[model samples]
Target chain A: MREYIYMDNAATTPVKDEVLEEMMPFFKEKYGNPSSIYSLGQTSKVAVEKAREQVAKSIAAKKEEIYFTAGGSESDNWAIKGIAYKNKKKGNHIITSKIEHHAVLHTCEYLEKDGFEVTYLNVDKDGIVDLEELKNSIKDTTILITIMTANNEIGTIEPIKEIGEIAKSKGIIFHTDAVQAMGNIKIDVNDMNIDLLSMSAHKVYGPKGIGALYVRKGIKLDSLITGGGQERNKRAGTENVPAIVGMGKAIELAYENLEEHNNKLISLRDNLIKKIEDSIDEIKLNGHRTKRLPGNVNFSFKYIEGESLLLSLDMVGIAGSSGSACTSGSLDPSHVLLGIGLDHEIAHGSLRLSLGDFNNEEEINYVVEELKKIVQKLRMMSPLYDKLEGEK
Target chain B: MYSKTVMEHFTNPRNVGEIENADGIGEVGNVKCGDIMRMYLKIEDNTIKDVKFKTFGCGSAIASSSMATELIKGKTIDEAMNLTNKAVADALDGLPPIKMHCSVLAEQAIKAALLDYSKKNNIHIEGLEDINFDDDLHDHDIEE
Candidate 1:
């Protein structure tokens, strides 16, 4: 069997062995409901609190402020809908960026159907939302401003601190979908002035189906899933004990080696970029060169389609994405790519390679070499390339 | 999603180069819409002796072109004209619903080549006259 190089970490990561080990006893040996009043249940309840503290410390958030949920989508829905409905009298308008994950975009679209207005802030060519445009779009009736900390496709880090300050000074609620940025970047809720944030365990080398929504103190809202008054009656569901334990351990490990992991990822990412650029022609780099995530390298090769390139890479055991993994099967090019002012052809030709902890220099070098060959072969077969030659 | 046959054609495509000074040539789709296919044909006494294709698109588009070329290589002009997108898709075991358009490119490219053949020979080919080469060929069935 060929060795697989998994470079689509922005989509999801493999669960750490240590995190899985920590979660093992919870499944069989410590199978008890946290809602139960027995001593067995107390063990589960204490485990839940400990995981909450672990999650809290990772983001510099208080344990009381964190509410466990299913994952990023739920956190996004709850944060947007909860705030919108709760403050409907105050304002019916919400602000978000065009490059946000569909978790936030679709939720905002749903809100638009029910008389709530939403303004989709556009990003610059580098995928950075204009702070001046954001300020001008904000109206007295704007109740919430939910921008992402970093983009999933191009990996452009948004100006979250400035956006947070703008919302805070205006006394409007601020929320961030930090699902992609959580493990890759350092985030302090207090320093960033973020009112609410969303994060998922699966993106941080933890198990799926476990995530948290950070709701700052004294900010009350309607509950999304009303049940047995769990999660302080804010979110109600039976806790996923094993997954939660895995998340806690995973995040604890992620932050412990954050700097070292980032350094390695940045080096691999930059080396990949330099090698590819040096070897290939008619290729344009997507996203901001310096402001992008350490692990991200997105590029658009002329005269080729991304899906074809992705399939070619897959044959060589390299896993990557054209844009967002969620929207890959769709015929339309990524909205995020288009939002950054790329033409439809350029957008369709885009590729995103996101690295993680397991990637090394050897794999990066192999990928760059394989990619050069694929691009050359595909270009030869491309009608557009023929046209370019004919024009020349 | 692609079938086994589609993957086979995509991996080792047949008739993938251009025929030099071909009798007729047809190109359809565009880079702007993400799939561009150029078809070359060599017709001898109403029979397609040679057919080749060059495509810039997804895996399905390349596979469709390869399969389409193989289907029409030895067929008469009339028989090649009867070829449909459905037949191309069926030959590939079947493509995903969204990727059904790639097969359409195959059908269109063949029709386009026949149209070019008719124009160059000045012989009015039936059914080839109706093909509108200017229309946007990429009609994606995107749900709102």
Candidate 2:
């Protein structure tokens, strides 16, 4: 068994055994391009449809609504930019939140240069986009409202249903990047009024390089990729049969265990939070205490830095993300942290440990112990820590 | 992962405090961007009597700040002013390429505070006005 402790579930999850099993045959003698006319090709096509059905069933959507893309970024780009271009005659304004993943933000930014106006709403300290703010931001020209269902950085969930409802009343479309929440949380696109939704396979324990966007049946969007007809002419190019197959299997498995998994995850996460909070001083939790995801525990220590904390934990065989992978090299803190009102020092000290199928009490305990030591040692050396101590 | 030296300096940072009624104090960085360094100096008779810094940054950031204070303390104003970011990185065994900027920021911040002190004492800090602190602050801007 692999002894490494993997806490970076939010970044990407390990492929589940069953998902891999479902994907295996697609790579071998059973392999065929889904677009071809031969029998082997037909087999792959049927598999793709079945996978599509499996995905649709999970979210209570029709099979034709799900369009597979390269990943969350591609799906996000397609959704925001695709919809923006296709709906240009309807309106040229879009509403979204400040804490949105760069996928949405960058796409919106790209649209701005093309004559689309975007309103970026601010979130509260816990990272929830306010309903009033959403309503106010909507205008007659507003065509879409894109907000994440759950934050990738702080794990704070926005009120997607309320925001979706508001958008619907105004005759505007609402899209959610549910990449982190899909498998972990039960989402009813119909109930939430999520007209367009996005999910990544890797985030749900499937494979990387495969993701899907849920475009409501009547919604119009220009195809982001122009190529051979595939995905009902919405998405083009060769389908990732193996990865899509794995995604279907993974989604099925995730839904089957969603409740139980969340229960386990919530307990573990809460326990981990408690253990660390009790052990360390000057520690502050970043996300909403209750509205946050079940598996994520994000916190900040006053005197310690996140990279130092991460590397210290890495030394003992633990892996996790500081924040969004997009902003990894930049010295600036995670924008989500800043949006939630954390200044640079504390934000730089932010650490997120997202639990998953692998983490258990023993591992949590080990992390706690190791973390306590690391924080203490790092704080001892921190010039800021010294000053804080001096002030005390 | 980081080197043992980085981990060491990060784990035992030096000059962690604020100077009161001091000769000079300089603060730089938008902490909202994740790295902030405030350098404090106490100079008497043209010799740096005490040097301290409080930095909120990554391992290399804390290490560089610690190294900066350690390098400048007990030195004359000229010697402290002559310190380079390279010296700080070298003292910490060597910072990662991405993190070298942290040391560079620390060096500029140290020089910034010294420049302020020179202005307060009416001494022309050699190359103080000639060197652009704001331009050196380019790396600190959070573009993403």
Candidate 3:
């Protein structure tokens, strides 16, 4: 069988063995509903509560503060809309960065249609949101500030702690979609003064369809889903017991070896970036050199489109992703890349190769070797590259 | 999503590169739209002797350009002029609905080249006057 190298961890991750093992009993033997009062149901309730506590502990949040949701998108929607609707009387203004995931951006756009004003702050070329612009965008009527902890495409880590402090000083509710940063970085909600935060399980090597929202105490927003009483009457639905158990174990394992995991990823990421930079000409690194996610390595190879490069990589058993319009099934490329001031052509050529716990030095070396050949091959077929070569 | 033929053409595209001092040259699409096809044709005795293309686009775009160049090679200029975007799409089995515009781009590129050929020779070809290469061929507009 041909060896496959999985590098698109930012997209999703394989569930860890330990997490799967912890969740096995919940699927079959302990299938009772957590809402039931009987012993078997009580066992499931206890397990759910334990997972909630595990999720809370990882982010330095109280056990009662964490509310389990379906996933990150739900958490994002719930946080943004819940705060907006409940506090409509207080304010109608929302502040967010232009580079936020569609979960946040689209939600803000939806709010805009309902007469809500949203300020999309601009970011620097390195994909970092300017604190000055962020501060300037804040208005007296700003009720909430929602920005991602780290970008999904570029992996640029935003100034969450500083942004949190600014929002706190301005008496505005601060929320961060930390789905990408949950396992990669250590987050202290208390220290950061974050009023709300979003996280996902699949990004941290847990099962999909399970996530949690951290709503700081004393901040009461409207309930997300309305149905039978569950999640303290905030989010209403039957709990996903096995997935919750998997998330609990996955998050615990992630935090348990956070330092080692980050170090390994950072090393591999840097090596890949350096090798690609040295080998390929006319390439631009997309995100900040240091103040970025440890696992992310995004670059734009000039004169070649991203989808072709991705196809070439896939043919060599290397899984990768791109910010091109063709890959996204849209007429425009990634908003994050465009937000960072990349023109359509450069943005179309962007490639994101995220590292993870499963990758090794040998895989990185192999990927770099394959990448050099692929870029060269694609460049030769490119009319843009042909023009440049002829000009030379 | 692309057909197997599209992938096959994209993998080993025929007639890649430029024709130096060619009789006609045509370029279509733009970098902003993330697709550009440049075709070079060598015409002699009103027949296309050879054709080559250089494209900077997605897999389907490259495949479309490759297939378009192959369809017109060794054919009369009038024959190449009659090639439609639908024929190019049909020849490749079929492209996804969204990517049908690539076939449109391929058709436009051929006409643009033939137009270039006519302008250079100062001779008019039937059905060539209607084409205006200046109009933007946005990827969203899929031609029938």
Candidate 4:
């Protein structure tokens, strides 16, 4: 069988073997509920507590501030809806950006239907939301300003510290969906003045279906999913012990090796950029060159379709994603790409190859070589390329 | 993963090039959704002797265009016009569930080319309904 190259790390990463090994005993040997009063249950409960403490330490946040949920979407929904509902009397106004993951955008849309006003901030060509625009959009009635720390598609890192400062000055709660940024980037919640932060374990080489929200002390919000008195009654559900344990281990490993992993990713990312640019023309880079995530690289070929390029790469055993993984089937160019001022042709022709823990120089080189050939072959068959070539 | 036939058609597409100074040209798709196909047909004596295409889109888009041309070349105009998107997908061993629309677009581009040919020759084609193209939304992306 041919070896396959898994390069779509931004979509999700495979859990570390060490993390998986640590989580296995919880799934089988200790299946008792954490809510139970028996000693077996107590064992599960203590394991959960240890996991929570480890999760908190990884992000430089306090143990009491972290609340485990399902994933990034839940964290986003809870953060947006919880704040909007709790502060309804304070103001019905909310603020976010156009290029955010649909988790945040759709949640904001839901709030809009419930009589809450929301301002969708626009980003520049580099997918960076204008600080001035975000500031001006804020009104006295604004209750929260939620922006994603790093865009999933283009990998542009937003000005979170400045945005947090602006929201703090206006006495508005600031929440950032740090799902993609959590493991790859260092986020100091206290230093950044972030009121609330969203994260997912899957994106950090952990288990899927496990994530948390960093709700700063003294923040009051109603729970969306109510059943038991778990998570301090802020979020109520039976804990996913195995996933949570795996998540905690993943977070610990990520922090312990953060600098090394980030440096390697950035090196691979920069090399991929240089390779593509050196061989191809009329290609535009999608995100902020320096402020973006170390592992993410998105680019738009002027006349070739992203799907075509992706499929071509797939044939060569190089797996990658075009646009966002969630919205690939919709036949619409990515809103993230469009929001960054890419034209329809370029936007639809975008490719995002995000690297992670297992990727090495050999895999990067092979993928880049295959990509060059695919782009060249596809461009030759492109009517748009023919027109552009004629003009030139 | 696609079937073997699909991969074959994708890698070594049958009708790969464009026909220059042909009897007619028909193009489908807009750049907005990132697919643009231009099919050039050389119809001689009421038979499609050569069918060629240039496509700018995804895997399904290229494979469908290839299948469409392979399915129609040397077939009579009537038989070619009767070809549907489902047949094109079958010819390429079936497109992915999400990308079946690319085959649909391929079938439309072929019919569109025939329509253009019929208009030029004053030979009324079967599916030529009252058609009005704005030339604004499509012309900028798809060219023949």
TM-score of each: 0.97, 0.87, 0.99, 0.95
- Candidate 4 — what's its lDDT? 0.86
Q: For residues A1-392, write the lDDT of model 3, one tens digit per residue.
A: 35899999999999988999999999899999999999999999999999999999999999999999999999999999999999999999999989999999999999999989999999999989899998888887999999899999899999899999999999999999999999999999999989999999999999999998999999989987999899999999999999999999999999999999999999999999999999999999999999899999999999999999998898889999999999998989999999999999999999999999999999999999999998999899888998787799
Candidate 1 global lDDT: 0.90
**Every candidate's lDDT:** 0.90, 0.85, 0.93, 0.86
Residues A129-208, candidate 2: write the lDDT tens digits: 88887887778899999999999988998888888888888889989999999888889999999899999999889999
DockQ of 4: 0.53
Docking quality of model 2: it rates as acceptable
For candidate 2 chain A, which ten residues in a row score worst on lDDT? A323-332
Q: Which residue pairs collide in model 1, if any?
A: none
Score residue B64 of candidate 1 by CA lDDT. 95
Model 3 ranges off by over 4 Å? B139-144
TM-score of chain A of 1: 0.98
Ranking by TM-score: 3, 1, 4, 2
Top-lDDT structure, candidate number: 3
Candidate 2, overall lDDT? Answer: 0.85
Worst 10 residues of 4 chain A by lDDT: A323-332
Q: Which structure among the candidates has the greatest DockQ?
A: 3
